[model samples]
Target: MTDVTLIFADLAGAAPLVMVLLGAAVFAMSRVSHDPRRMVRVLIAIGILLFVRLSFPLVIPLLLNDVIGAREVQVRVLWNALFYSVPNSIALGLLFWTIFDVGRARSAEEMTRA
Candidate 1:
């Protein structure tokens, strides 16, 4: 394989990290008996995010081979359209929403305690 292929193959190096993310999602999901809706959203959004990240290395082979396109611009457009721009946006939004939700809940609890 070329150096380019080797470099792209390194993208899969994060596969273990993705597994950790999935495990965390499953653990968080186990604690959500009180809110089925939130649980579903969290699972779906995190699943999508994890799968997208996990599959990034799978696309590198196509990218190196010019199956998608030869030009860098075409590759950028494809990456943005297919993976980086839309799906990640929604996934990250959902992640932030979860964080915000937890912060708000904590704030409310502290207010009540005070």
Candidate 2:
């Protein structure tokens, strides 16, 4: 492997550790939270992130070779798209969910106070 590939492998190897740390933090926070459903959402988000992280190693190797057919190329393209889109979609979903959740909680607090 070249220097860049070695660096890439090292970084990829660390992805799981980062994910686990994130999971641990989420677990700790969820324990203190009153809403169990929030914990569920967070777990789901973490699962999605883990899936994307694990798929990273396979994606490059799977797409690196030459393709001889239109169908094969299309299939590879779809896999690449799926791999890339999943993480992005999860992130956007979490972003919106967090914003909406915070807004709803604030509104509820104000209503209760009033």
Best by TM-score: 1
Q: For model 1, how does the per-residue alpha-carbon lDDT over 31-103 read when each residue is reduced to its tens digit?
A: 6775566677788778877877766556655665566554576766676476556777897788778767864
What is candidate 2's lDDT per residue for 18-89, written digit by digit as tens? 678587557747574555566566666666666566555554444444332224667767766776786859
Off by over 4 Å in 2: 1-13, 16-33, 63-82, 102-114
TM per prediction: 0.61, 0.51
> Which candidate number would show the highest lDDT if scored against the true structure?
1
Task: Report the Cα lDDT for residue 106, model 2.
Answer: 48
Question: Where does the lowest 10-residue lDDT sum fall in candidate 2?
Answer: 62-71
Cα lDDT of candidate 2 equals 0.61
Give candidate 1's TM-score: 0.61
Candidate 1 to native Cα RMSD, angstroms: 4.9
